[model samples]
Target: MKLYQRLHPGVNLGPTDPENHEEAEEKIFGFWIFLMSDLVLFSVLFATYAAMSIQGVALGPSPKDIFDLSPVFLETMVLLASSFTFGLAILELKYRKNQGRLALWLTLTGLLGALFVGLELNDYRILLTEHGAAPQTSGFLSAYYLLTGTHALHVSVAIIWLIVLAVQLATLGPVGPVKLRLMRLALFWHMLDIIWIGIFTFVYLYGVVL
Candidate 1:
């Protein structure tokens, strides 16, 4: 089969034909293992937040007092939209092979990611200033900052990666290595999206509702 025919979103493009490129398969598998390790790290962070948040308010503001659902909702929408745009970029590269179109989609993805980070920082500022809540204020606040700040750090890295990838795509024009790197980056980006969903549900929605 042709390369484009075999390529699909979220599908591994690394040498499936074991006889020809066994090394490529190994690399892809190793990258997956790395992602799994990251999952564990995020899982731990989530558990810590859940545990520490219950009674760690410690005379400080509660989640309901500090978390504004409006900005949280907006941040969630922005990140989700970035993920969608990234999927579009992948489709463009896999099907259309239009470098310009792919660049446009990737740029949109980066912009949305930046917006999410900006909103998150603004939220943090509000928590610190308006509510007098900082990481040092209480255990709950510390956990909250650690969890959300870690996720924000990942988002920041992703935005930087997107910029670098865009430059590579512009210069190299989606060659084999470029395509493989893009696929790996896509996996990482999608993983962040999934992690954010956990954060939104467990941290934001739960905080507001419960």
Candidate 2:
């Protein structure tokens, strides 16, 4: 048996080192499979949004009126930075063997995510009160609510997850279940950042520019 194999207390039905290169490769492939399924779900939502957008509301503000690229730009930057921080957290956990630093970085990740959501909510409030562009006001509003709200819901969930993991890291430290959970969380955070990039590009930027 390999040294890692001998050291692992759990049954070697699979991998011991969760981030072991070979195991990580297999896991990433599996995650991509699951992500494909998720993509299908998002595709359906996009199609729905597209269909609804065609039935445009006559009186309400369109994307041109409601969206400001500047806030979105900042939100995107925060998430992108958080993704990089998560990568650093993982690298630290794997290479440097630093638990306090790992948790600190993860906490920062959570804060960044919270900041993004806060900005989103703030934007929505401003749009609704200041501009009278609530979701009920337009078909464009409907689609905007559906798409951005979906992503916001996702962000909320991720934040909750980060909080839970923060607790876990505090009590359990970075091994076994904690380690696996953190690794999965890292993947999730990265995925959110990438998805936000698409949202900003396709939904916000293109929506604005075009």
Q: Whose TM-score is greatest here?
A: 1
RMSD of candidate 2 to the truth, in angstroms, is 5.0
> What value does the lDDT take at residue 146 in candidate 2?
81
- Which candidate number would show the highest lDDT if scored against the true structure? 1
Candidate 1's C-alpha runs over 4 A off are 1-25
All candidates: TM-score: 0.89, 0.83
The residue-by-residue lDDT of candidate 1 on 66-151, one tens digit each, is 77788888888899999999999988876677888898999999999999999999998888788889899988989999999999
Clashing pairs in 2: none
Deviation (Å) of 174 in candidate 2? 1.2
